[model samples]
Target: MTKTPPGLPLRDYAALGDGRTVALVAPNGRVDWLPLPNLDSVPVFARILDEETGGSVELVPREAYESSRRYVEKTNVLETTFTTASGVARVTDAMVTGVAGRLPWAEFARRVDGLEGSVEFTWRISPGTMLGTRSPWLDRVGEHTIIRCGQLSMAVVGSDHGPASSDPTSADPAELHGHFATTAGSRHLLVLTATEGEPLRVPDPAKVDEGIDRTIDSWLTWSDEFSYEGPWSEQVQRSALALKLLIHSPTGAIAAAATTSLPENPAGGKNWDYRFAWIRDLAYTAHSLTWFGLREETHAAISWLLRTIREQGPDVLVMYSLGGSTCAGVVEYDVPGWRGIGPVVTGNPAQGQLQLGIYGDLIAISRTYVDDGNLLDVETARLLAKVADKVCDEWRSRDAGMWELEDEQHYTSSKMGCWQALTDAIALADGAHINGDVARWRAERDRIHDWTDEHCWSEDLASYVMHPGSDRLDASVLLHAPSGFDRGERMSSTIDALTRELGAGHLLYRYSGVADEEHTFVACAFWRVSALACVGRHDEAVAAMGALVTQTNDVGLLAETVAAGDGAFWGNLPQGLSHLALINAALMIKDLAPKEAHDDQ
Candidate 1:
């Protein structure tokens, strides 16, 4: 195993994806985590996980330097400027896409332009391990040098540096290395192209360089269509871009996060894989995408979800693979995790856990789509109608709640999920969008509301408990406040209780007992903002959201958890749910907050 450098904090890395796969780039110009061919595949660069064996495409200066970075306008393209004693160089990193969309083959381009005096730059390509299991071999095929690992083959083109051309004596050498000096106004291009299970081909470097601008333009053009003109507009757009990175364009499944097994706590074995699409996350993404008036992605995600649900109807898994198939069970990798945290995992085991809340989430998407004046096909309407019926049969059963907790209980939030599902279904039926037993749905909705109000409310805590008879408070209940179950005294008091119990300033832990295991959840904080708006705490909600947006990293990316004590990031990053929550909260605050009153003097 080749020795690798220390890993950077999650906050220092920015993501660049072509809507097919994402690459995490540190400020030091290293591509740390990139899954080849697709986002869920084995990573070609896993340096973030294992510093020793995990390989990276490293481009950095040899001398001492300092750096800063930002996205190029409204794009996922990352630009890092490195300044040294001799000069400065600006590096633009992109996972290039065609003008139409993602390319048939994977192409990652790094273009560096010197801005000042000449500065020496060094780079190395080390194909360390295929998802941290084995090493890849270096070979020269005809004119192009190839690195092969299992079914993946890659080549680096457009490097004129000396060592980049040197031949390797060993078939499995540690790395290919090189150095070049950049002068003012000089531009250098390095393109890494790969293919899986097919013949390898390389495009001209000049054309690949041209593709970078086209990719940036595509991102800008997509973002320009966003209709969000609310508070935190910049961060909301950044969150949208991050959410866009997680959407698998081909299948339209939104991944929960870009990487897996980033532990919520380093010492705790809570490193769950988040590569698969949780229907809950997909539903949230769909709702937020619709909120921003981005019609294409919203429709794509909704269509894919309903299509997949129809295929697995009468019973639905909590999660599915990016291909809309059953998830492969969990596999623990041999590689050490980031910072030597062990037991890195690949797949998720919660697919079979019955998260009853998905009924509400799934039905809500159809409601949003139909409410926007679009018509659902007969098949989708039937699928949702059946889901509502399934909710009738399943809501009484004790099952995993929205957190996918192991302990099954009569969760308040799950009941609220049923209530939301039935209420939406009743509305759809009233609108003639779906055919269902409207009277039955109405009765069940009322039953759920009555039962929840009776069993879940705590006289002492003044908020809904995590479950019946449990004294614990849950922040997830905030997700339902906007649905208007009560709109009066109970929800108002619950807001104060949640603020006192689960909140740390504007941030919030997931529930009562999780502070020891993880940090305050990013999405829960955003949910609190929405809940505040729903309950008429308009000024407080705006203030809380204003402070919450400050928690995002420099490039406006968020991880799953923000450490309650110190605000350090933990868990899987560029989290789609976190970004989705931010967008949704902004929209809610914009819609619900009162307009300024006119003054007549």
Candidate 2:
């Protein structure tokens, strides 16, 4: 019987999808999390949030077995090999997509193939409705089953996919439930789809097989557009796939992670839902997509941001729902958290905070567009002018830091963002996008920079402080190296001090001043790596990048942070900003590695 994967030090899970929806499959045969129809939809299977009560879809061989798995070439098709005393079995898993000119919002399919000797397999499909609050009642109709909960109706078609046997201890079932035995050269397919109108007729096995073949071909063709040929091409490609999976195809909204409240520190109250789109995520994603030459999705995401910012007004929330809906106040749930983390939250409360850094994020995106030869339209320019006016009016106000801390302070990072806004605004005006006082904007921009250098730096610490008069160092300053600030001896010394003080082996702490007991922020670590490379510290940068790559889960997916000692993952999994940082860091290392090593040689 397929036992729970040997409780080895299994790193976190990797993700795979067909661009429309995502599925988090464990190193074992269980699919831990998946939202139906789209990435932001209420989850249909949510075992990752609450392992015991929440539902999951498991496809396990009915034999004591060992297994290894990976994706099939350039596509997102997951292939696993199960080894048993009898023999071995290989199962290929994928959430099938439309093909042959079919509409994207169609059916989803998973296919299992048997290789080697005869292998018996079992599966369970318990539909979690109302986001794991209630399990749906199942009614068998003809050869199909209908699971109805509230307004959502899910249809499951196929035999040999159901609940586990009642042995309570039997690894192999005598009477199989949703169970089937396949010999050499045998194959099986399972299909799941949703319908709001009248129920559609279920397709036969022949049609399902055709769909599977077409879906595989479609993914292969789509992945061909990825032009990144780096030293670690496979890992980079996989990272790109993980980033793509979080994108909601219909609305162009990218979720922070597939699961929510996964916990920054296991058993801590740092858990927060990341299934919504943050403006910061959109800007970073735009930059990454521009680098990768995926302009269509990037433009769509930026347009989504523009619409959201327009509707939400200049006082934009930090984040919003996929369709631009406001996120309600966070609510605590009774679910047992990951590894016993407490206080799992359902939404993010940082939505309404007054963060001055967003102005810089918008300006950075606008600059990227203009640099890419894609002109910011007159309307976009006008909107940016409005944002700049706000920045000008509130440039001296104290607000939350980039970490979004509660106690308002004169955060150096926010001030730097204000500097970035004015600097980029001057460039936007040069493009004739708006009629603004360019001379005044330039003066204010330089003043902000001068103030940051004068007040935010500390002589004793020898690095930029988190805020004026604060002794703590923040990893966020590592970003200034790439922001094209004065990166001379002072900046280099500051980067080195940060490396020594906050670097937890490879992972870097977000800030040293705060009482935050969370994991080291993975993006900060990458930012430091990039800064090290840029400052001609190639040896340090290479070692840092090596250590960072080692922390990726078995399938090459990275969470927001890694535990300093235990190496357990912390924070949200497959963070977009983190992955974006990884790509940019790789680029920086590539450009600087040779120059520094040669200078020494």
Best by lDDT: 1
lDDT of 2: 0.73
Q: What tens digits encode model 1's per-residue C-alpha lDDT throughout 1-601?
A: 9874356788888999988899999988998899898999988788889887788898999999999999999999999999999999999999999967889999999998999997798888887686567678777889778888879889888644435754467543847777888999999988889999998879898898899999999988998888877678999999999999999999988999999888798685889888888888998888888877889998998888888877866587898899998888889988888877657888987988988898898898889999887999999888888889988888898988988889999888899999999999998999999998888888888889999999999998887889999999988888888877756678788878888888888899999978877789999999989988888888888899999999999999999999877778899998988998898898888888676611110
* Model 1: lDDT to the true structure: 0.87
Tell me the RMSD of model 1 versus the true structure: 2.7
TM-score quality measure for candidate 1: 0.97
Error of 1 at 229 (Å): 0.8
How do all models score by TM-score?
0.97, 0.91
Give each prediction's root-mean-square deviation over alpha carbons. Answer: 2.7, 4.0
* Tens-digit per-residue lDDT, 148-235, candidate 2: 5545566656533444333325432211237777667777776666643345546565676676677678767767877776555676
Highest-TM-score candidate: 1
lDDT (Cα, 0-100) at 550 in candidate 2: 76
* Shift in Å, residue 480, candidate 2: 1.7
